[model samples]
Target: MNILIFFPSIDNGGPTNVVLSLLKGLNKNKNINIHAVYFWGDNDNNLDVINSCCDSIYKLDKVNLKSLYKLLAIIKEIKPDIVHSHCLVPDFFNYILSLCYSYKSVSTLHCNLDEDYINEYGFIKSHSYKFIHKYILMKINNVVSVSKSVLKAIPEVKAKTILNGIEELKTPLYKDNLDVINLLYVGRLIKRKNISFLISCITEINKIRNKKIKLTIVGDGELKSILKIKSGKNISFIDFNDNPFACGVENTFFINPSLSEGMPIAVLEALSLGLPVLLSSIPAHIEINDKMTDGVQLFDFNFESINNAIESMLIDCNNIGYRNKIKSQFQDNFSLNTMSDNYVLEYKLMLEG
Candidate 1:
């Protein structure tokens, strides 16, 4: 079978990682051919990896009217058995093209479109975003949500829940002197992410714990300037990294204080490295803790709650053996192999249906 994967771009983000993981995992299948196309991107790290994963790659320059025609032309040429897409724009075009094409179409709903658009675009514009997204999603041939939280977001559409997975590399037990506890947050520094509060909570945490807390904020966004203003030397910011297991994995704890998430890839990457995670008690994170991962702990979006959770982890830090269990749990549930196998099944079902 020939499968063509489509996405808006190949940036170093969760959606891109999903595309990469799917491509890499599916590329191993001898019976199937994997092809991929993207609108625009410049993440060289991911670009190289994507090039190596797919049998063919199409760069459409940018998302525009001309690109739409270009994409339609590619679909005509490829004549894939199934066309699977990621992200909003690609999903839209994939659905649009499906009207005139014979190939089965599938799209991965990476986040809760309603809340996500509200956070990014705000009230009025968000309505339009939500309306358009809902329409396209409903019309799409097959829909897959990265988490049950996301699946719940769109009750109108029939979507299969397949939680996002990550590429796990073998990591040795790493401790950065144990004097400083590295708290990591990977992904965009957006308002809804509530990262500013995370930085402030570290202050209260440091005051209580004997060890100082260091926060390494990864990814860039509009909130970058605000986060810089709010943070001191203890908090350092890095541009977007494909890696979330920065600093030292053993001493580091991944903390995401987002108001929402849809199976965040960074959290999975950190867990793969056996880094304990303290996530905001959002539905998505709660779903992960309750059903998916054993190592994740949820904290309410408050200083007391976050500080207490940090203190508990710090107290239990010396019991390094548990980190291995976290890594093992990751392999069991959120590994790329498991996700790919599920997607392969879904692809077959889409064809059969």
Candidate 2:
């Protein structure tokens, strides 16, 4: 079967990585012919990885009226059995294209659109975009959400919860050094991610402990410059690493104090690599934390709560046995093969209908 994966752009985040994981997993099927199109310019490194997974790749100079026509032309030429899109813009565009063509289309919700939009833009603009999105989504074939929280948030539009998955390594990476506890945060430095909150907590921890704890942030965004100024010597920033699972092995713990999330791929990748996690008490994080209790800790989106959670992690950072147990639980539940198989089934079902 021919499948066209449409994305707004290739960026350093969970959504892009999730799409890449799907492409890699689906490519294993001999009958599947995968083609991917990006609405905007590509991230060179991510594009190279995507090129290896897809049979063909197409990129529009930018998302505009001309690009829309070009996208439609490519869709007509490809004549794919299914068109799967990620993010709001791409999903809406695919819905528009579906109106003109007779092909099955599916969209994956990467976050709670309502909250995300309001957090980025103000309430009025967010609500306006929400109305537009709801209108377009109502006409889409199928909607898949990465977390139950996202599906619940969009009750107006029907959606299925399909949690993001990562590949399970044959041998999990084990951190050898236990003297200095390394805490890792892997995602964009956006306001909603609460990167500043994380920095403050780390700063507080350093004040309590004499540089025994270190935070390694592994992503960049708009707040990079401001965050660097706020961060001290205990905290260090690194460019986004596509293979976070490999990086997780070098760290003692993973922490995400984001205000909101939709089954964050970084958290999943970290858990799969046997890194204990300290997450905010968001619905998505709670859903995952409920499954296992030993190596994962959840805190509210406050400085006091974050400071307490970090202290707890520092105390238990030497517990290798607990961390391994978390890895075993993650392996049993979230797997790249299982996620791809479910999407393939969804595509078949949509086509049959």
* lDDT of model 2, residue 9: 74
Give the per-residue lDDT digits (tens) of candidate 1, residues 1-353. 89999998887777888888988889888888888999887888888888887888999966788888998898888889998988778888888888988889888999888778899899999888778888898998889999988766679999888888777966465557677777888888899888888888887666666457888888899999988998877888888754545454567888899988888888888888888889899988887787544567789978889877887777665675887888888888889999999999998887788
Worst 10 residues of 2 by lDDT: 242-251
**What is the lDDT of every predicted structure here?**
0.83, 0.82
Model 2 C-alpha lDDT per residue in residues 81-132, reported as the tens digit of each score: 9999988788878988898998998989888877788987889999988887
Cα error of candidate 1 at position 305, Å: 0.5
Runs in model 2 deviating more than 4 A are 169-177, 208-211, 243-251, 311-320
TM-score of each: 0.94, 0.90
lDDT of 2: 0.82
